[model samples]
Target chain A: DVKVTQSSRYLVKRTGEKVFLECVQDMDHENMFWYRQDPGLGLRLIYFSYDVKMKEKGDIPEGYSVSREKKERFSLILESASTNQTSMYLCASSPGQGVVGELFFGEGSRLTVL
Target chain B: GESVGLHLPTLSVQEGDNSIINCAYSNSASDYFIWYKQESGKGPQFIIDIRSNMDKRQGQRVTVLLNKTVKHLSLQIAATQPGDSAVYFCADGNQGGKLIFGQGTELSVKP
Candidate 1:
């Protein structure tokens, strides 16, 4: 079974602080995604990287950025965290073209920006 | 704009009863669809998936039905159990591989 591991299960930060959420996938999947899950809003994509050193902005990318320096690791950075940014962050990976969009997800990191 | 949305926000069913969750998508060009189950404090888990060409697919105790013409999708669960209670989301994967998720349906199973 494929495993997507998240570095932190829960985090709390003050406003204007910078936060880093890390994720790693065991399988050599080509696509990695970061999403934020909010009540009533569902899961909104933050950023996605298809390969090393490549990243694309998703629907909601403001105040957030991502890094994919290696095949197995992807990181999401919150430049200046705010109270409004408090939400659950999810990391997912897929096998690109042949997989038909089935994403394996890690246990989400719940962020509470104070 | 393309979006995926669910018709109902919550569904309550008794144990041993069947449950149906409905979703509607706006993008006709979407080729792949998936159903996800998300428990509290965890990320969404893949339940099942159906391609555009196929109308129906079944998994253990779960079934996914897609209606391309109406752009509607449904997931049916047989003999609902307490463990089946969770938030369910339907996602659409477009040609570019970007996934759009629905608002999700919260399934509550009563004993």
Candidate 2:
């Protein structure tokens, strides 16, 4: 069984505050992703890392940044939190070699910005 | 930007009945697709997947059918149980592994 662990299951931040969400995967997958899910909007990709220290901006990367300092850990940073940035954030990982691999996800972090 | 979307936003079914959820993808270049189930306050869980090469795939109690011609995908649940209630999403990916997800369909299983 693959395990992806998130640092926080719930968080609340004030406007203009910095927020960090951490994720770690035990399966040694090469691909890591951050997504924000909203009602009726589904899961929109924020950022993804294919390898350690490598990253790519996803569809909705504005106001968000990510870090992949090590192979097993990925972090999402909200430079300045705002009410519009509040959403359920999810982390996922997948093997690098497969053509169409399934992503194993961590329990999401529900962030509320006030 | 390519988009993946669902036909319905919600579906309700009785326990022991079957449920079908539909999704549509706009990217014809997408070669792979996956179905996911997400419970409230939880991340999305992988259900089943089907490649462009195959039209159908089955799992323990779920089946995924893909129609490339219409760019449609469907997930069918057999003997729906309370645990089967969740938001279902379909994702399309090219060979590069970047997945574009659809607006999910929320399933409500009634006893």
Candidate 3:
């Protein structure tokens, strides 16, 4: 079974603070994604990386960035956290190339900005 | 311009009954669809997937049906149980591998 590990299960931060959510996948999947899940809004993609040091902006990428320095690890950075940014963040990974749709996801990190 | 939405926000069913969750998508160009189940405090897990060309696919006790004509998709879970209580989301994927997820339908199974 594939395992996606998230560094934090819950986090609390003040406004204007910087935050980092880390994710690591055991399988050698080439595609990694970061998404935010909110009530009534569903899951919206924040950023995705297809390869090491390569990243692409998703639908909602403002105030967020990602770093993929290695194959197993991917990180999401919130440059300046705000109250509006309080939400559950999810990390997922999938195999590279082909019509890949099945994504293995890690336990999400719930961030609360005060 | 592209969106996926659920017809019902919540559904409640008795144990051992069948459950159906409906989803609609606006993008006709979507090549495939996937169903994900998310339990409380956990991320969404892949349940099943169906290609656009195929209308129905079954896995374990779950079945996924896709209708291109109406741009609709549905997941049918037979014999609902307490473990099946979770938020179910249908996502549409394009060739680029980007998925547009629906505002999930919460299924509550009464035991």
Candidate 4:
């Protein structure tokens, strides 16, 4: 079984504060993704990394950025958190194998920006 | 921009009944599709997947059907259980690993 772990299960921050959310995967998958889930709109991609030190912006990457410093670790950074950024954040990883596009996801981090 | 969307936002079914969730994708270039189940306050979990080459694939208790001509996908759960109650999402994967997710359908299993 593959395991993906997020640094925090729940977090609260004030407006304009910088926030960092970390994700680690035990499977050493080559693909990592960050997504924010909101009511009505569903899950929207924020950023994704195909390899270490490489990242691509997803559909909703306006106020967020990501880092893939190591193969097993990926981080999502919010330069300036706002109330609108409060949402459930999810991290997922998939193997480099082309055949399987399945994503194993970690327990999401619920962020509340006040 | 390409988008994936569900026909219904919510579906209710009995515990012993079969559940069908439908999704539509706009990207004809998408070659891979996956169904995900997400419990309240948790990340989405992979349920099943199907490639463009195949029309159907079955997992433990779930089956995924894809129609490339209409760009539609459906997930069918046999003998739905209380544990099957969750928000279900369908995603399209292109050449790269990036997935475009659809607005999820919330399934409520009635006892």
How high is each candidate's TM-score? 0.97, 0.97, 0.97, 0.95
Worst 10 residues of 3 chain A by lDDT: A94-103
Off by over 4 Å in 3: none
Which portions of model 1 show Cα errors greater than 4 Å?
Answer: A97-100
lDDT of 4 by residue, A1-111 (tens): 999999999999999999999999999799898999888898898998888999988899999999899999999999999999999999999998433488999999999
Kindly state the number of residue pairs that clash in model 4.
Answer: 0
Interface RMSD of 2: 1.7
**DockQ (model 3, Cα):** 0.75
lDDT of 3 by residue, B1-111 (tens): 689999999999999999999999998888788999999989899999999879899999999988899999999999999999999999988836678789999999998
Q: For residue B111, what is the lDDT in candidate 3?
A: 89
Poorest stretch of ten by lDDT in candidate 3 chain B? B92-101
Give the alpha carbon lDDT tens digit for every residue of A20-88 in model 2: 999999998899999999999999999998899999888999999999999999999999999999899
Error of 1 at A45 (Å): 0.2
Tens digits of per-residue lDDT for model 4, B83-109 = 999999998888355788898999999
Every candidate's DockQ is 0.69, 0.72, 0.75, 0.62
